[model samples]
Target: MLINKSFANQAGVSLIEILVTTLILGVGLLGVAALQISSLSSNQEGLFASQATAIAEDYASRVRSSKTSTVMPNTNISYAQFVAAYHNGNNAPLACAAAPAQLCRSDAGNAALDCTLAQLAIYDQWEVCSAAQEALPGGLVRVLNNGIRLTIVVDWDSEQGREDIGNVAVRNNNCSPLTGSNTRNCVILELVP
Candidate 1:
Protein backbone atom coordinates (compact mmCIF):
# COMPACT_ATOMS: atom_id res chain seq x y z
CA MET A 1 0.00 0.00 0.00
CA LEU A 2 1.11 3.59 -0.78
CA ILE A 3 0.18 6.88 0.97
CA ASN A 4 -0.58 9.99 -1.14
CA LYS A 5 -1.25 12.77 1.47
CA SER A 6 -0.11 15.71 -0.75
CA PHE A 7 -2.60 14.82 -3.55
CA ALA A 8 -5.50 14.68 -1.06
CA ASN A 9 -4.53 18.06 0.51
CA GLN A 10 -4.56 19.89 -2.87
CA ALA A 11 -8.24 20.52 -3.75
CA GLY A 12 -9.48 21.90 -7.09
CA VAL A 13 -10.25 25.46 -5.77
CA SER A 14 -11.05 26.91 -2.33
CA LEU A 15 -14.50 28.61 -1.65
CA ILE A 16 -12.78 31.75 -0.24
CA GLU A 17 -10.67 32.17 -3.38
CA ILE A 18 -13.72 31.90 -5.68
CA LEU A 19 -15.67 34.46 -3.63
CA VAL A 20 -12.73 36.90 -3.65
CA THR A 21 -12.34 36.60 -7.41
CA THR A 22 -16.04 37.25 -7.95
CA LEU A 23 -15.94 40.34 -5.73
CA ILE A 24 -12.97 41.77 -7.63
CA LEU A 25 -14.65 41.15 -10.99
CA GLY A 26 -17.86 42.77 -9.78
CA VAL A 27 -15.99 45.85 -8.64
CA GLY A 28 -14.23 46.13 -12.00
CA LEU A 29 -17.53 45.80 -13.86
CA LEU A 30 -19.05 48.54 -11.73
CA GLY A 31 -16.18 50.86 -12.58
CA VAL A 32 -16.68 50.19 -16.30
CA ALA A 33 -20.40 50.92 -16.02
CA ALA A 34 -19.69 54.23 -14.27
CA LEU A 35 -17.30 55.20 -17.03
CA GLN A 36 -19.88 54.40 -19.66
CA ILE A 37 -22.47 56.58 -17.92
CA SER A 38 -20.08 59.52 -17.73
CA SER A 39 -19.19 59.22 -21.41
CA LEU A 40 -22.87 59.30 -22.40
CA SER A 41 -23.51 62.40 -20.31
CA SER A 42 -20.57 64.22 -21.89
CA ASN A 43 -21.72 63.25 -25.37
CA GLN A 44 -25.21 64.63 -24.70
CA GLU A 45 -23.79 67.93 -23.53
CA GLY A 46 -21.72 68.24 -26.70
CA LEU A 47 -24.79 67.51 -28.81
CA PHE A 48 -26.77 70.32 -27.16
CA ALA A 49 -23.88 72.74 -27.63
CA SER A 50 -23.59 71.91 -31.31
CA GLN A 51 -27.30 72.41 -31.80
CA ALA A 52 -27.16 75.81 -30.12
CA THR A 53 -24.25 76.94 -32.29
CA ALA A 54 -25.95 75.88 -35.48
CA ILE A 55 -29.15 77.69 -34.52
CA ALA A 56 -27.23 80.86 -33.68
CA GLU A 57 -25.31 80.78 -36.96
CA ASP A 58 -28.47 80.21 -38.95
CA TYR A 59 -30.12 83.35 -37.56
CA ALA A 60 -26.93 85.38 -37.89
CA SER A 61 -26.54 84.45 -41.53
CA ARG A 62 -30.15 85.23 -42.29
CA VAL A 63 -29.91 88.60 -40.62
CA ARG A 64 -26.76 89.42 -42.54
CA SER A 65 -28.44 88.50 -45.81
CA SER A 66 -31.30 90.90 -45.11
CA LYS A 67 -29.39 93.73 -43.51
CA THR A 68 -30.89 96.45 -45.70
CA SER A 69 -34.05 98.10 -44.43
CA THR A 70 -36.26 97.96 -47.51
CA VAL A 71 -39.51 98.81 -45.75
CA MET A 72 -40.79 102.18 -44.49
CA PRO A 73 -39.86 103.68 -41.12
CA ASN A 74 -42.72 101.93 -39.31
CA THR A 75 -42.03 98.62 -41.00
CA ASN A 76 -38.27 98.83 -41.35
CA ILE A 77 -36.76 95.33 -41.12
CA SER A 78 -33.46 95.06 -39.27
CA TYR A 79 -31.53 92.47 -37.28
CA ALA A 80 -32.53 94.32 -34.15
CA GLN A 81 -36.16 93.83 -34.98
CA PHE A 82 -35.59 90.17 -35.69
CA VAL A 83 -33.89 89.72 -32.34
CA ALA A 84 -36.69 91.56 -30.57
CA ALA A 85 -39.27 89.37 -32.24
CA TYR A 86 -37.63 86.34 -30.69
CA HIS A 87 -37.59 87.81 -27.18
CA ASN A 88 -41.05 89.36 -27.26
CA GLY A 89 -42.55 86.31 -25.58
CA ASN A 90 -45.07 85.73 -28.32
CA ASN A 91 -45.69 82.01 -28.78
CA ALA A 92 -47.46 82.21 -32.09
CA PRO A 93 -47.74 78.72 -33.56
CA LEU A 94 -45.87 78.20 -36.81
CA ALA A 95 -47.22 76.13 -39.71
CA CYS A 96 -44.82 75.30 -42.51
CA ALA A 97 -43.35 72.32 -44.34
CA ALA A 98 -39.71 73.11 -43.48
CA ALA A 99 -37.88 72.33 -40.28
CA PRO A 100 -37.38 76.00 -39.38
CA ALA A 101 -40.88 76.80 -40.69
CA GLN A 102 -40.87 79.35 -43.44
CA LEU A 103 -43.17 82.35 -43.35
CA CYS A 104 -44.91 81.27 -46.54
CA ARG A 105 -44.80 78.05 -48.49
CA SER A 106 -42.70 78.26 -51.65
CA ASP A 107 -44.23 76.70 -54.72
CA ALA A 108 -41.96 73.88 -55.88
CA GLY A 109 -38.78 75.75 -56.97
CA ASN A 110 -40.16 79.28 -57.28
CA ALA A 111 -39.44 81.93 -54.62
CA ALA A 112 -41.79 82.54 -51.70
CA LEU A 113 -44.77 84.54 -52.94
CA ASP A 114 -45.92 87.78 -51.28
CA CYS A 115 -43.26 87.63 -48.52
CA THR A 116 -42.47 91.16 -47.29
CA LEU A 117 -39.37 92.37 -45.48
CA ALA A 118 -41.16 92.62 -42.13
CA GLN A 119 -42.60 89.17 -42.59
CA LEU A 120 -39.17 87.85 -43.41
CA ALA A 121 -37.73 89.34 -40.21
CA ILE A 122 -40.46 87.87 -38.08
CA TYR A 123 -40.16 84.56 -39.84
CA ASP A 124 -36.41 84.46 -39.35
CA GLN A 125 -36.73 84.96 -35.61
CA TRP A 126 -39.62 82.54 -35.34
CA GLU A 127 -37.76 79.88 -37.23
CA VAL A 128 -34.62 80.28 -35.18
CA CYS A 129 -36.47 80.04 -31.89
CA SER A 130 -38.60 77.14 -33.07
CA ALA A 131 -35.65 75.12 -34.27
CA ALA A 132 -33.69 75.84 -31.08
CA GLN A 133 -36.52 74.89 -28.76
CA GLU A 134 -37.35 71.76 -30.71
CA ALA A 135 -33.76 70.57 -30.80
CA LEU A 136 -32.58 71.39 -27.27
CA PRO A 137 -34.29 70.47 -24.03
CA GLY A 138 -35.78 73.40 -22.06
CA GLY A 139 -34.32 75.80 -24.61
CA LEU A 140 -34.51 79.61 -24.35
CA VAL A 141 -33.17 82.24 -26.74
CA ARG A 142 -32.02 85.76 -25.89
CA VAL A 143 -30.53 88.57 -27.95
CA LEU A 144 -28.53 91.50 -26.62
CA ASN A 145 -27.64 94.62 -28.63
CA ASN A 146 -24.60 96.66 -27.60
CA GLY A 147 -24.53 99.49 -30.14
CA ILE A 148 -22.12 97.94 -32.68
CA ARG A 149 -22.35 94.37 -31.45
CA LEU A 150 -25.03 91.71 -31.08
CA THR A 151 -24.91 88.71 -28.79
CA ILE A 152 -27.17 85.72 -29.24
CA VAL A 153 -27.61 83.58 -26.15
CA VAL A 154 -29.14 80.11 -26.03
CA ASP A 155 -29.90 78.43 -22.72
CA TRP A 156 -30.88 74.81 -22.12
CA ASP A 157 -31.20 72.39 -19.24
CA SER A 158 -29.26 69.13 -18.92
CA GLU A 159 -29.78 65.98 -16.92
CA GLN A 160 -26.17 64.93 -17.03
CA GLY A 161 -24.99 63.30 -13.75
CA ARG A 162 -28.22 64.52 -12.19
CA GLU A 163 -29.54 61.03 -11.84
CA ASP A 164 -26.72 60.05 -9.53
CA ILE A 165 -26.25 63.32 -7.64
CA GLY A 166 -29.72 64.89 -7.20
CA ASN A 167 -31.67 68.04 -8.04
CA VAL A 168 -29.42 70.91 -9.08
CA ALA A 169 -30.10 74.58 -8.35
CA VAL A 170 -29.89 76.61 -11.54
CA ARG A 171 -29.41 80.38 -11.31
CA ASN A 172 -30.50 83.01 -13.80
CA ASN A 173 -27.50 85.28 -13.32
CA ASN A 174 -27.09 86.28 -16.98
CA CYS A 175 -25.48 83.00 -18.06
CA SER A 176 -22.41 83.11 -15.93
CA PRO A 177 -20.15 80.17 -15.06
CA LEU A 178 -22.15 77.37 -13.44
CA THR A 179 -21.13 76.18 -10.01
CA GLY A 180 -22.07 72.96 -8.20
CA SER A 181 -25.54 74.43 -7.70
CA ASN A 182 -26.14 75.26 -11.36
CA THR A 183 -27.25 72.67 -13.87
CA ARG A 184 -28.17 74.67 -16.95
CA ASN A 185 -25.79 75.41 -19.85
CA CYS A 186 -25.62 78.48 -22.05
CA VAL A 187 -24.06 79.04 -25.48
CA ILE A 188 -23.26 82.59 -26.48
CA LEU A 189 -22.47 83.81 -30.01
CA GLU A 190 -21.60 87.40 -30.76
CA LEU A 191 -21.87 88.88 -34.24
CA VAL A 192 -21.81 92.38 -35.77
CA PRO A 193 -24.27 92.11 -38.65
Candidate 2:
Protein backbone atom coordinates (compact mmCIF):
# COMPACT_ATOMS: atom_id res chain seq x y z
CA MET A 1 0.00 0.00 0.00
CA LEU A 2 2.89 2.44 0.85
CA ILE A 3 4.70 1.95 -2.54
CA ASN A 4 1.52 2.43 -4.55
CA LYS A 5 0.76 5.69 -2.76
CA SER A 6 4.28 7.15 -3.61
CA PHE A 7 4.08 6.25 -7.34
CA ALA A 8 0.64 7.90 -7.67
CA ASN A 9 2.05 11.20 -6.31
CA GLN A 10 4.77 11.46 -9.11
CA ALA A 11 2.44 12.20 -12.14
CA GLY A 12 3.95 15.74 -12.63
CA VAL A 13 7.36 14.26 -13.72
CA SER A 14 5.95 12.86 -17.00
CA LEU A 15 4.56 16.26 -17.99
CA ILE A 16 7.97 17.92 -17.39
CA GLU A 17 9.79 15.39 -19.67
CA ILE A 18 7.27 15.92 -22.48
CA LEU A 19 7.80 19.71 -22.38
CA VAL A 20 11.61 19.35 -22.56
CA THR A 21 11.43 17.00 -25.56
CA THR A 22 9.13 19.36 -27.42
CA LEU A 23 11.55 22.30 -26.89
CA ILE A 24 14.51 20.36 -28.30
CA LEU A 25 12.57 19.22 -31.37
CA GLY A 26 11.48 22.78 -32.15
CA VAL A 27 15.06 24.06 -32.07
CA GLY A 28 16.25 21.36 -34.45
CA LEU A 29 13.56 22.25 -36.97
CA LEU A 30 14.54 25.90 -36.83
CA GLY A 31 18.14 25.02 -37.60
CA VAL A 32 17.12 23.04 -40.66
CA ALA A 33 15.07 25.92 -41.95
CA ALA A 34 18.07 28.24 -41.73
CA LEU A 35 20.26 25.77 -43.59
CA GLN A 36 17.74 25.53 -46.42
CA ILE A 37 17.68 29.30 -46.85
CA SER A 38 21.47 29.53 -47.06
CA SER A 39 21.65 26.76 -49.62
CA LEU A 40 19.12 28.47 -51.89
CA SER A 41 21.01 31.73 -51.79
CA SER A 42 24.29 30.02 -52.70
CA ASN A 43 22.66 28.19 -55.59
CA GLN A 44 21.40 31.47 -57.03
CA GLU A 45 24.88 32.98 -56.92
CA GLY A 46 26.34 30.05 -58.83
CA LEU A 47 23.65 30.31 -61.48
CA PHE A 48 24.39 33.99 -62.07
CA ALA A 49 28.11 33.34 -62.52
CA SER A 50 27.49 30.59 -65.05
CA GLN A 51 25.11 32.76 -67.08
CA ALA A 52 27.57 35.64 -67.27
CA THR A 53 30.32 33.38 -68.59
CA ALA A 54 28.19 31.72 -71.26
CA ILE A 55 26.82 35.02 -72.58
CA ALA A 56 30.30 36.51 -72.95
CA GLU A 57 31.50 33.50 -74.96
CA ASP A 58 28.44 33.62 -77.21
CA TYR A 59 29.24 37.18 -78.35
CA ALA A 60 32.87 36.27 -78.91
CA SER A 61 31.93 33.42 -81.24
CA ARG A 62 29.54 35.62 -83.21
CA VAL A 63 32.20 38.24 -83.74
CA ARG A 64 34.60 35.61 -85.04
CA SER A 65 32.24 33.95 -87.55
CA SER A 66 30.85 37.25 -88.82
CA LYS A 67 34.19 38.90 -89.44
CA THR A 68 33.67 41.99 -91.60
CA SER A 69 36.94 41.72 -93.55
CA THR A 70 36.82 38.28 -95.13
CA VAL A 71 38.67 37.90 -98.42
CA MET A 72 36.51 35.07 -99.75
CA PRO A 73 34.61 35.69 -103.01
CA ASN A 74 31.28 35.69 -101.21
CA THR A 75 32.30 38.47 -98.82
CA ASN A 76 32.24 41.88 -100.54
CA ILE A 77 32.94 44.23 -97.64
CA SER A 78 36.30 44.95 -95.99
CA TYR A 79 36.99 44.27 -92.33
CA ALA A 80 37.48 47.97 -91.62
CA GLN A 81 33.98 48.78 -92.85
CA PHE A 82 32.46 46.10 -90.64
CA VAL A 83 34.29 47.44 -87.59
CA ALA A 84 33.19 51.00 -88.33
CA ALA A 85 29.53 49.96 -88.67
CA TYR A 86 29.62 48.19 -85.32
CA HIS A 87 31.24 51.17 -83.61
CA ASN A 88 28.79 53.68 -85.04
CA GLY A 89 25.75 51.73 -83.73
CA ASN A 90 23.66 53.07 -86.60
CA ASN A 91 22.19 49.86 -87.88
CA ALA A 92 18.75 49.64 -86.30
CA PRO A 93 17.02 46.33 -85.72
CA LEU A 94 15.00 44.99 -88.65
CA ALA A 95 13.84 41.84 -90.40
CA CYS A 96 16.64 42.42 -92.86
CA ALA A 97 16.85 38.79 -93.85
CA ALA A 98 13.22 38.86 -95.05
CA ALA A 99 12.11 39.76 -98.62
CA PRO A 100 11.92 43.29 -100.08
CA ALA A 101 14.84 44.74 -98.09
CA GLN A 102 16.54 41.34 -98.04
CA LEU A 103 19.19 43.11 -95.96
CA CYS A 104 20.68 39.90 -94.54
CA ARG A 105 20.96 36.49 -96.21
CA SER A 106 23.88 34.07 -95.99
CA ASP A 107 22.44 31.50 -98.43
CA ALA A 108 24.13 30.98 -101.81
CA GLY A 109 21.20 32.56 -103.76
CA ASN A 110 21.62 35.99 -102.15
CA ALA A 111 23.49 38.71 -104.04
CA ALA A 112 26.23 40.90 -102.53
CA LEU A 113 25.11 43.77 -100.20
CA ASP A 114 21.53 42.41 -100.09
CA CYS A 115 21.72 43.40 -96.49
CA THR A 116 24.47 45.94 -95.98
CA LEU A 117 27.43 44.66 -93.95
CA ALA A 118 26.58 47.23 -91.28
CA GLN A 119 23.09 45.80 -91.00
CA LEU A 120 24.49 42.37 -90.25
CA ALA A 121 26.66 43.78 -87.47
CA ILE A 122 23.74 45.58 -85.90
CA TYR A 123 21.53 42.54 -86.05
CA ASP A 124 24.17 40.37 -84.41
CA GLN A 125 24.64 42.89 -81.59
CA TRP A 126 20.94 43.07 -80.89
CA GLU A 127 20.59 39.31 -80.77
CA VAL A 128 23.41 38.91 -78.27
CA CYS A 129 22.45 41.82 -75.98
CA SER A 130 18.83 40.75 -75.93
CA ALA A 131 19.66 37.19 -75.00
CA ALA A 132 21.94 38.28 -72.18
CA GLN A 133 19.39 40.60 -70.62
CA GLU A 134 16.71 37.96 -70.82
CA ALA A 135 18.76 35.26 -69.15
CA LEU A 136 20.41 37.29 -66.41
CA PRO A 137 19.40 40.14 -64.13
CA GLY A 138 20.25 43.67 -65.19
CA GLY A 139 22.59 42.43 -67.89
CA LEU A 140 24.62 44.87 -70.05
CA VAL A 141 27.44 44.54 -72.55
CA ARG A 142 30.34 46.90 -73.19
CA VAL A 143 32.51 46.50 -76.29
CA LEU A 144 35.79 48.39 -76.61
CA ASN A 145 37.81 48.51 -79.81
CA ASN A 146 41.39 49.67 -79.39
CA GLY A 147 42.54 49.49 -83.04
CA ILE A 148 44.54 46.30 -82.42
CA ARG A 149 42.38 44.46 -79.91
CA LEU A 150 38.79 44.13 -78.77
CA THR A 151 37.49 43.77 -75.22
CA ILE A 152 34.04 42.45 -74.40
CA VAL A 153 32.73 43.15 -70.95
CA VAL A 154 29.52 41.49 -69.76
CA ASP A 155 27.94 43.02 -66.69
CA TRP A 156 24.96 41.95 -64.56
CA ASP A 157 23.41 43.00 -61.31
CA SER A 158 24.95 41.22 -58.33
CA GLU A 159 22.65 38.96 -56.37
CA GLN A 160 21.87 39.88 -52.82
CA GLY A 161 23.53 38.03 -49.85
CA ARG A 162 26.80 37.87 -51.79
CA GLU A 163 29.20 40.04 -49.88
CA ASP A 164 32.30 38.75 -51.64
CA ILE A 165 31.02 39.34 -55.16
CA GLY A 166 31.87 43.02 -55.44
CA ASN A 167 35.23 44.51 -54.61
CA VAL A 168 37.46 47.44 -55.43
CA ALA A 169 38.90 45.64 -58.44
CA VAL A 170 35.47 45.00 -59.95
CA ARG A 171 34.48 48.65 -59.56
CA ASN A 172 37.79 49.83 -61.05
CA ASN A 173 37.43 47.63 -64.10
CA ASN A 174 33.69 48.12 -64.63
CA CYS A 175 32.39 51.67 -64.33
CA SER A 176 28.98 50.56 -63.09
CA PRO A 177 27.62 47.81 -60.89
CA LEU A 178 25.48 44.99 -62.28
CA THR A 179 22.41 46.76 -60.92
CA GLY A 180 21.91 50.17 -59.41
CA SER A 181 21.18 48.68 -56.00
CA ASN A 182 24.06 46.27 -55.50
CA THR A 183 27.61 45.59 -56.63
CA ARG A 184 27.74 44.63 -60.28
CA ASN A 185 29.39 41.45 -61.44
CA CYS A 186 31.72 41.76 -64.41
CA VAL A 187 32.75 39.06 -66.87
CA ILE A 188 35.61 40.46 -68.94
CA LEU A 189 36.84 38.75 -72.10
CA GLU A 190 39.70 39.92 -74.32
CA LEU A 191 39.79 38.91 -77.97
CA VAL A 192 41.11 40.14 -81.33
CA PRO A 193 37.58 40.28 -82.73
Candidate 3:
Protein backbone atom coordinates (compact mmCIF):
# COMPACT_ATOMS: atom_id res chain seq x y z
CA MET A 1 0.00 0.00 0.00
CA LEU A 2 1.18 3.51 -0.80
CA ILE A 3 0.87 6.48 1.48
CA ASN A 4 -2.04 8.74 0.58
CA LYS A 5 -1.60 12.52 0.43
CA SER A 6 -4.01 14.62 2.46
CA PHE A 7 -6.21 17.15 0.66
CA ALA A 8 -3.98 19.90 2.04
CA ASN A 9 -0.83 18.15 0.62
CA GLN A 10 -2.39 17.78 -2.84
CA ALA A 11 -2.37 21.09 -4.68
CA GLY A 12 -5.70 20.61 -6.39
CA VAL A 13 -7.65 18.39 -8.80
CA SER A 14 -6.05 17.99 -12.24
CA LEU A 15 -7.76 19.89 -15.08
CA ILE A 16 -8.99 16.61 -16.66
CA GLU A 17 -10.38 15.41 -13.31
CA ILE A 18 -12.00 18.79 -12.73
CA LEU A 19 -13.62 18.65 -16.17
CA VAL A 20 -14.92 15.11 -15.57
CA THR A 21 -16.34 16.03 -12.18
CA THR A 22 -18.00 19.12 -13.60
CA LEU A 23 -19.64 17.03 -16.33
CA ILE A 24 -20.90 14.58 -13.75
CA LEU A 25 -22.20 17.34 -11.48
CA GLY A 26 -23.90 19.06 -14.37
CA VAL A 27 -25.71 15.88 -15.36
CA GLY A 28 -26.66 15.19 -11.76
CA LEU A 29 -28.02 18.68 -11.32
CA LEU A 30 -30.10 18.37 -14.45
CA GLY A 31 -31.52 15.09 -13.19
CA VAL A 32 -32.47 16.71 -9.90
CA ALA A 33 -34.15 19.62 -11.62
CA ALA A 34 -36.16 17.23 -13.78
CA LEU A 35 -37.27 15.37 -10.66
CA GLN A 36 -38.39 18.62 -9.07
CA ILE A 37 -40.44 19.53 -12.11
CA SER A 38 -42.04 16.10 -12.20
CA SER A 39 -42.88 16.32 -8.50
CA LEU A 40 -44.60 19.68 -8.96
CA SER A 41 -46.60 18.37 -11.89
CA SER A 42 -47.68 15.29 -9.93
CA ASN A 43 -48.72 17.46 -7.00
CA GLN A 44 -50.83 19.67 -9.23
CA GLU A 45 -52.60 16.64 -10.70
CA GLY A 46 -53.29 15.27 -7.22
CA LEU A 47 -54.87 18.56 -6.24
CA PHE A 48 -57.11 18.56 -9.28
CA ALA A 49 -58.09 14.96 -8.58
CA SER A 50 -59.04 15.87 -5.02
CA GLN A 51 -61.08 18.84 -6.16
CA ALA A 52 -62.87 16.76 -8.78
CA THR A 53 -63.63 14.06 -6.21
CA ALA A 54 -65.10 16.64 -3.87
CA ILE A 55 -67.31 17.98 -6.61
CA ALA A 56 -68.53 14.49 -7.38
CA GLU A 57 -69.26 13.65 -3.74
CA ASP A 58 -71.00 16.96 -3.20
CA TYR A 59 -73.40 16.31 -6.05
CA ALA A 60 -73.98 12.77 -4.86
CA SER A 61 -74.89 13.93 -1.34
CA ARG A 62 -77.22 16.52 -2.80
CA VAL A 63 -79.15 13.81 -4.64
CA ARG A 64 -79.63 11.78 -1.48
CA SER A 65 -81.14 14.74 0.36
CA SER A 66 -83.98 15.27 -2.08
CA LYS A 67 -84.86 11.73 -3.11
CA THR A 68 -88.58 12.00 -2.43
CA SER A 69 -89.27 15.42 -3.88
CA THR A 70 -87.78 15.18 -7.37
CA VAL A 71 -90.42 17.48 -8.71
CA MET A 72 -89.82 18.62 -12.28
CA PRO A 73 -89.63 22.41 -12.73
CA ASN A 74 -92.76 22.79 -14.85
CA THR A 75 -95.52 23.08 -12.23
CA ASN A 76 -98.51 21.78 -14.26
CA ILE A 77 -96.65 18.82 -15.77
CA SER A 78 -96.14 16.78 -12.57
CA TYR A 79 -93.09 14.58 -11.74
CA ALA A 80 -94.66 11.43 -13.18
CA GLN A 81 -95.47 13.14 -16.46
CA PHE A 82 -92.02 14.67 -16.86
CA VAL A 83 -90.44 11.36 -15.98
CA ALA A 84 -92.66 9.50 -18.40
CA ALA A 85 -91.77 12.05 -21.04
CA TYR A 86 -88.14 11.57 -20.14
CA HIS A 87 -88.33 7.78 -20.22
CA ASN A 88 -90.05 7.40 -23.55
CA GLY A 89 -88.00 5.73 -26.35
CA ASN A 90 -88.27 8.70 -28.67
CA ASN A 91 -86.16 11.77 -27.93
CA ALA A 92 -88.21 14.23 -25.90
CA PRO A 93 -88.49 17.60 -27.69
CA LEU A 94 -85.37 19.84 -27.70
CA ALA A 95 -87.10 21.63 -24.85
CA CYS A 96 -85.89 18.67 -22.78
CA ALA A 97 -82.84 17.10 -24.45
CA ALA A 98 -79.80 18.79 -22.89
CA ALA A 99 -76.97 19.34 -25.43
CA PRO A 100 -74.32 17.82 -27.67
CA ALA A 101 -74.33 14.01 -27.89
CA GLN A 102 -78.00 14.96 -28.23
CA LEU A 103 -78.60 12.68 -25.23
CA CYS A 104 -81.88 13.79 -23.79
CA ARG A 105 -81.74 16.54 -21.19
CA SER A 106 -78.60 15.19 -19.46
CA ASP A 107 -75.37 15.09 -21.43
CA ALA A 108 -75.30 18.90 -21.70
CA GLY A 109 -71.79 20.36 -21.58
CA ASN A 110 -70.18 23.81 -21.64
CA ALA A 111 -71.14 24.40 -25.23
CA ALA A 112 -71.33 22.58 -28.56
CA LEU A 113 -67.46 22.64 -28.50
CA ASP A 114 -65.87 23.07 -25.02
CA CYS A 115 -65.63 19.47 -23.77
CA THR A 116 -63.48 20.86 -20.94
CA LEU A 117 -62.21 18.68 -18.12
CA ALA A 118 -65.11 19.89 -15.95
CA GLN A 119 -67.63 19.33 -18.70
CA LEU A 120 -66.31 15.86 -19.51
CA ALA A 121 -66.51 15.07 -15.80
CA ILE A 122 -70.30 15.24 -15.83
CA TYR A 123 -70.90 14.16 -19.41
CA ASP A 124 -69.67 10.61 -18.94
CA GLN A 125 -72.53 9.42 -16.74
CA TRP A 126 -74.03 6.03 -17.60
CA GLU A 127 -77.37 4.49 -16.61
CA VAL A 128 -78.17 1.34 -14.65
CA CYS A 129 -81.07 0.35 -16.87
CA SER A 130 -80.85 -1.37 -20.24
CA ALA A 131 -81.96 1.87 -21.84
CA ALA A 132 -80.05 5.14 -22.11
CA GLN A 133 -80.16 7.58 -19.19
CA GLU A 134 -82.36 9.86 -21.31
CA ALA A 135 -85.02 7.18 -20.95
CA LEU A 136 -85.04 7.75 -17.20
CA PRO A 137 -85.68 10.92 -15.24
CA GLY A 138 -82.74 13.21 -16.13
CA GLY A 139 -81.42 12.78 -12.61
CA LEU A 140 -80.81 10.10 -10.07
CA VAL A 141 -83.38 10.45 -7.26
CA ARG A 142 -82.17 7.75 -4.89
CA VAL A 143 -79.43 7.85 -2.28
CA LEU A 144 -77.93 4.82 -3.95
CA ASN A 145 -80.29 4.55 -6.87
CA ASN A 146 -79.70 1.25 -8.65
CA GLY A 147 -81.87 2.45 -11.52
CA ILE A 148 -79.62 5.43 -12.22
CA ARG A 149 -75.86 5.83 -12.44
CA LEU A 150 -73.33 8.65 -12.70
CA THR A 151 -69.71 8.71 -13.70
CA ILE A 152 -67.53 11.72 -13.13
CA VAL A 153 -65.23 11.74 -16.11
CA VAL A 154 -62.21 14.03 -16.31
CA ASP A 155 -59.77 14.32 -19.17
CA TRP A 156 -56.80 16.50 -20.04
CA ASP A 157 -53.99 16.62 -22.53
CA SER A 158 -50.45 16.36 -21.24
CA GLU A 159 -47.02 15.44 -22.58
CA GLN A 160 -47.40 11.86 -21.46
CA GLY A 161 -50.83 11.04 -22.86
CA ARG A 162 -54.51 11.87 -22.73
CA GLU A 163 -56.02 11.22 -19.30
CA ASP A 164 -59.54 10.00 -18.71
CA ILE A 165 -60.73 8.69 -15.36
CA GLY A 166 -64.15 8.58 -13.76
CA ASN A 167 -65.81 7.48 -10.53
CA VAL A 168 -68.98 5.43 -10.58
CA ALA A 169 -72.27 6.68 -9.21
CA VAL A 170 -72.17 8.22 -5.78
CA ARG A 171 -75.38 8.85 -3.80
CA ASN A 172 -76.67 12.41 -3.99
CA ASN A 173 -79.26 14.44 -2.08
CA ASN A 174 -80.63 16.01 -5.27
CA CYS A 175 -79.84 16.38 -8.94
CA SER A 176 -78.09 19.52 -10.26
CA PRO A 177 -76.12 21.00 -13.19
CA LEU A 178 -78.74 23.69 -12.81
CA THR A 179 -79.63 26.74 -14.91
CA GLY A 180 -77.52 27.71 -17.90
CA SER A 181 -77.64 28.23 -21.69
CA ASN A 182 -75.12 25.42 -21.70
CA THR A 183 -77.20 23.11 -19.54
CA ARG A 184 -76.13 19.74 -20.90
CA ASN A 185 -73.54 19.04 -18.26
CA CYS A 186 -75.71 20.79 -15.68
CA VAL A 187 -78.74 18.71 -16.61
CA ILE A 188 -76.63 15.75 -15.70
CA LEU A 189 -76.77 16.98 -12.12
CA GLU A 190 -79.91 19.15 -12.34
CA LEU A 191 -82.14 17.12 -10.07
CA VAL A 192 -79.64 16.86 -7.21
CA PRO A 193 -80.24 19.08 -4.22
Cα lDDT tens digits, model 2, 3-39, are: 7887777757587789999999999999998888677
Which stretches of candidate 2 lie above 4 Å from their native place? Answer: 1-13, 68-113, 159-182
lDDT of 1 by residue, 130-185 (tens): 88778887666666665566677776776542445343324446565421225667
Error of 2 at 111 (Å): 13
Better of 1 and 3 by TM-score: 1
Alpha carbon RMSD to native, model 1:
6.1
Instruction: For candidate 3, write residues 118-156 as lDDT tens digits.
Output: 233233232221122222223221112212343322221
| lDDT score for candidate 2 against the true structure | 0.61
The alpha-carbon deviation from the true structure for residue 38 of candidate 2, after best TM-score superposition, in angstroms, is 1.8
**In candidate 2, what residue range of length 10 has the lowest lDDT sum?**
90-99
> After superposing candidate 1, which stretches have Cα over 4 Å from the reference?
1-8, 68-111, 114-116, 160-174, 177-181
Per-model TM-score, in order, reads: 0.69, 0.61, 0.39
**1 or 3: which has the higher lDDT?**
1
Which candidate number has the best TM-score? 1
Which residue pairs clash in candidate 1? none
